[model samples]
Target chain A: MADYILGVDGGGTGCRATIADTSGKVLGTGQAGPANIMTDMDTSVVNILSATDAALLAANLPVHSYSRITACLGLAGANVSGVAAQLQQALPFANSSVVSDGIIALQGAIGDADGVVVILGTGSVYISRRNNSVTMKGGWGFKVSDLGGGARLGQKLIEESLLVHDGIYKRTPLSSALLKHFDNEPHAIVRFAHDARPNDFGQFAPLVFEYAAQNDPLADKILKQSVETIEAALDASMHDDQPVLSLIGGLGALYGPRLSVRYQPRLRTPQADALTGAVALAAKLYTQTAQS
Target chain B: MADYILGVDGGGTGCRATIADTSGKVLGTGQAGPANIMTDMDTSVVNILSATDAALLAANLPVHSYSRITACLGLAGANVSGVAAQLQQALPFANSSVVSDGIIALQGAIGDADGVVVILGTGSVYISRRNNSVTMKGGWGFKVSDLGGGARLGQKLIEESLLVHDGIYKRTPLSSALLKHFDNEPHAIVRFAHDARPNDFGQFAPLVFEYAAQNDPLADKILKQSVETIEAALDASMHDDQPVLSLIGGLGALYGPRLSVRYQPRLRTPQADALTGAVALAAKLYTQTAQS
Candidate 1:
């Protein structure tokens, strides 16, 4: 049996690792650079290794202690990458397995209990767990869907900015600021959007919330539409039994208060972060198998 | 001086040619293959030449007659390609120049008269002409702004279908039909959307209309949003003098009756097609230069 358990939460923006005793007691944690395996597996591998090393060092464990660890990694973009299955071979840990970053978030939020978790960051994902059965919905990515995610909000703002330029929509305070970024050229907006990745689109989402605070009509309109998407996702995710619901991610708290009235009562603060979820999962997976 | 004026309208889907007498009398017309200069200038040149050859044949003129013709071409994607300026050197015409396809659309709908023409085909372009001056709005292309264009309508429907799959939106008659296109796999929808071009998205737009005819709630919702976009574009295009308004393109007549009541009084059927407008410009340009 492994002497220690390692948990990894890898995402497009960053990578995190947590080390613990076999029983799941906290030991140490560390974070590293972007680890989106789908776009760049080599980079993800390097960052994941660095994150694990940092966690080991922080725990005052020997450099070769990784040989005694059992790891379960939750990584973003795992589905599209054929390289993910081979990731275990490349890792320093004794045993490692890969799952989606969303799963880690789900475990962190609801923990083995039956409930639902909605992550609203650059992308959006809704996952529900009932009777230990899990199902995922939404999070189809930015172009076709992201719904309440920041990337979609930012893209929607750019789309609306063009409408303002075309005289289809009335101008608001945010219009000038948004236009200034594109140099008042609608073609520039189109060009930027043409090659922009989801992260690029997400960069402008904060501007909408800022302008909405000032009572800008266009901003208000955009936020309202976004809030509705969040509400809709919640409606689909929650059941008649009313499972415990938690919103997690950069925009999670931001969207909480603005959600429809019915969702307010059901919304609960997440008990832990994805890294914590990853570590917990690592402990459970290894301990159960080790005993058996 | 050139004895004949040739007008060419080149688009993403097809190329058209018109040959007329110097006095603006129509002599003959021809059609050929796809000619979007932005994506494929070489193709556009080939199709334009073929269209010209066919028009000359229909007019009972020799192939060499192209040397005696002056042409003005309105082409799709003229703005994006520097090759547009050099098109005169590649063409069979004696004197030639290039302009946006939208300009030809405007001239085709209103002729020398002042009015606004909204082209609502696979994509959308809105142009207004007044006091012999012209200004264009919208039609920034898909992914950013097409407003009420069919590509946008279709893309919007696909996005909605995913929402239905996510349980965010309820299943309707249209939902099953849409999911079938992707083999009922949400990830397939994501993959298809990642690489889908504007024309690809446009293909699904007709489905929205088909389901709307049956009173499918999702279809009705999608169409209503699309109509609002079209109406918004119209409001921006219209002026106090209330110049004639024409909706021209594949979905033009379909959207005509669905327009807000306020626009009904101002709406007028287009007088001609883009090919006719091109020939008229060719005649005017050469005849004026000849007199000077």
Candidate 2:
């Protein structure tokens, strides 16, 4: 009975949904608020539904036409145990599957082909698909992991600035500027960090890259460290028979060139965005279920 | 008139009070729960009072005799802008001085002499005294600073374990043991870290040392990193005319031997504990006030 495929990409900041036909023709797109399931499942579900309703309305479909849609949701925090199952159970659709945001990103970047996608957004994750199997590295979250992500880069910047404050590290213009951003008050930075989310820390990441571009020693050091970590993660995710690698997300382009030349030729542009991949997956699921 | 001097060392874990006469002869001691001023000022004050009252009772003095005590409180979180002044105003005593826990630890370790005390407990701070002036390095806090503290060491351990899980870092008994402790579920570790306090992370520190002693490569790497950071902090705190260096706190002895041999000859045994240093400060304050 499904007439349309719905692709949803949900994260801590916001949610986006797209409506497409089986032939992959886009019908409409919509957006809503944060939908990170682990933090607030009810809110995430609500946001997902709201985005889907908007997409359906934009497609000139009735609000009650959800039963004719097969949805594939790729969400941040969906990898947490019980989240995907709970989300699948809660969704109001003809057929739906919930997966991690990274998976959709990988699929969107490379389509049905076997390749790798390195997501370098507020957080980081390296996901690779081979044949029909997929594996991942990193993206373990912030403070403990997400080594080369924007949040980690910003966090290290704050730490180095404090070290400069304590005379443990040589002060630089980059560090001085970072300290000035905090009003030169270490306690204020501490207070801010205590309750900071990943995005809050990620806000400082662009400054790091900007300073590094000017050959600021401290900024260069931080970027080098981050690059090394990302390289290690990419290396770990690689297999002998691996396909092309695509860098994705906000910091993807910034990090791309900084990576070693060995990885340059292996990098490929993503064929489509995550929402397109989500719809592609929805279409595949609809066809398979119909045959079954 | 005040007849006795009181020294109080308060931290995030617990509070300790020592009662002494003007000559620094220890009379009695008492203990109570955490008294970190910034986190909970009212509880800190209450715990400080409770510990002082118990110390008085143990010294065979009446609890009502608090007005006769000149108290010195060396408290964690007192370095924050208004914590010391706020705590001083809230005290119930003949006179009181509130200084950082690191200051009292340095004073207790070397008496009136000049020296540096490197505190390596649940948190870290390097305090140095030269003549009548004092300076500090490191000990900004955990996750931002506190580089070589137990919390940082444990945090590194968890990070390595996750890397091992991701195959980015090689597996070792140390990493395996840590992963097992978390039920082999990465999500469990993430959940624990989401709400973890410094002490919670510090709880895993001993295992890192234990594994290093057994020659676990991953453990050795973490320790080396921590030692390097600590050495940097120690070097930064050292002045041209710096006095003896004393290592203090729970992991002090463990880290002492691991430090570079060049710094070994500079280390000295503490003359007394932080509580004793606190009492000495109280006595000194009382004398200065009386002379004025």
Q: For this target, which candidate reaches the highest DockQ against the unseen true structure? A: 2
RMSD of 2: 1.9
The root-mean-square deviation over C-alpha atoms between each candidate and the true structure, in angstroms, is: 3.9, 1.9
Q: Which runs in model 2 stand beyond 4 Å of their true positions?
A: none
Taken over the whole model, the C-alpha lDDT of each candidate is 0.84, 0.88
TM-score of 2: 0.96
Clashes of each: 0, 0
lDDT of 2 by residue, A1-292 (tens): 4388899998988999999987768889899999989989999888998998888889887765888888899998888888899989998898999999888898899888777899998888999888789998888888689888999999999999999998889999999999999999999998998888888889999999999999999999999999998898888887767768899989988998898998988888778888878888998998998889
- How far out, in Å, is residue A6 in model 2? 0.6
Per-model chain B TM-scores are: 0.89, 0.93
Reference-based lDDT, residue B247, model 2: 89
Per-residue alpha-carbon lDDT of candidate 1 for residues A111-168, written as tens digits (9 for 90 to 100) = 8877889999999888888877777787888878877899988988988888888777
| Model 1: per-residue Cα lDDT at residue A132 | 75
Model 1: how far residue A58 lies from native, Å:
6.9
